[model samples]
Target: MMTTAVPAPAISVRGLEKSFDDLRVLRGVDLDIERGSIVALLGSNGAGKTTMVRILATLTRPDAGTVMVDGFDVMTDGANVRECISLTGQFAAVDQILTGRENLKLVAKLRHLDDPGGIADEFLARFDLVDAGSRRVAGYSGGMRRRLDIAMSLVGNPPVIFLDEPTTGLDPEARIEVWTMVQELATRGTTVLLTTQYLEEAEKLADRIAILHEGRIVANGTLAELKELLPPAEVEYVEKQPSLEDIFLALVGKNAPEGELR
Candidate 1:
């Protein structure tokens, strides 16, 4: 009899736990992300989202449990894990003094790429930053800086990436730009694990979503599956109302008609 081979997950975690002094951040978390897929880890404030990313990225050691990225154990094979993954934290990590092109070149050089300048120019074009690549990053807009930060992370072309609250503090248009870039990355077969507080962001980008609460994953599934977990929608006498976000956007001209106010 012939048997088929099962591919290894891009990222796998089993019974993961972490603690700092008297505080326990993660409590027996488990996750599995398929190769070339995007997964969103959702959680509220102080819900251990950052801690989980830190452990998986090998920046912090988990007190217990196991984490494997592309079949390499995060704890025992940290160097290999690092080589296969790129991480973009909450804040932009680009140097303020360097131009956008220089920032990308710096990362490429650090990774020992043979043609750092060529790679830098390629990514600048890819991220639509060619116009601003020559200007100092300190003078760039928040969206431009964020784009440069992500471009730098791609210098080595790692197979997997971790984006921790990547769109934080950006205006709506800027956030949409970043979202488009992220979608392009996934389409190119990069496995992405991102932590986000925005439900809309997850709904738009993630193939599957996992919610963390009180240090444990309370729910994990696709958006439709998760919606099934909730009570069925009830019939209402009145028309459904728009969300606060919808109202805010409508009032602030975001959703208003051009040359007219609602």
Candidate 2:
């Protein structure tokens, strides 16, 4: 019988450390993200999630520990690590002055890829922005702008994508749109590591959830696995009935003036 070796993770961090003067952002954090999977980094406002992402993307150097992306060391092989990763920050980085298509083309050109126009066209169609391709990004909706920003980050098909608080300021509807987009990225074999404070977002998107607290990953596992950390709740059953509010709404919908309840 022959045994197959396990493949290396797309992104790996061990004993990572970082500090800013008196503030220590990360302390001996370790994580491994499998290839083509979505891993949500969950933390509160000051949990250093962004700091960890910056180090992985090679935008910031870690004070200690070994970090690797796509088999390339972030400290020693910075360029290769960068080539393997794309970082999308909290806010959309699209140009308000340029058309949505132009923004994609600009990124494609910067990456030195052949046929920027074609790349732009492909992404615009893929992100369902073909109609708004020619309109200035300033006129696009929040969801549309976010989609375009993500498409720009993917111009060169980087193997790993870092989304740092991707849906920070979007409305509920817009947030849902971005959530769907994140799911699509994983389905297309793109490895995504998104940092977010929204617990529901992590529950809905991540294959595995890692909770960062006080500069360390305190918990890491799937939703069910995390649930096992706590004692299971006592199962209870009770009769249910519609409340007065629910009954009133139901009645209004059927009998209100001109069906105005809608």
Best by lDDT: 1
* Candidate 1 per-residue lDDT over residues 33-97, each given as its tens digit: 99888999887788899999999999999999999999999999999999999999989999999
Q: lDDT per model, in order? A: 0.85, 0.84
Tens-place lDDT digits, model 2, residues 2-117: 99999999988899999999898898998999999999987667779888998888888899999989999999999988887899999899999999999999999899999999
> Which regions of candidate 2 are displaced past 4 Å?
235-262
**Could you tell me every candidate's TM-score relative to the true structure?**
0.89, 0.88
Per-candidate clashes, comma-separated = 0, 0
What is the lDDT for 115 in model 2? 98
Candidate 1 steric clashes:
0
Q: In candidate 2, what residue range of length 10 has the lowest lDDT sum?
A: 253-262
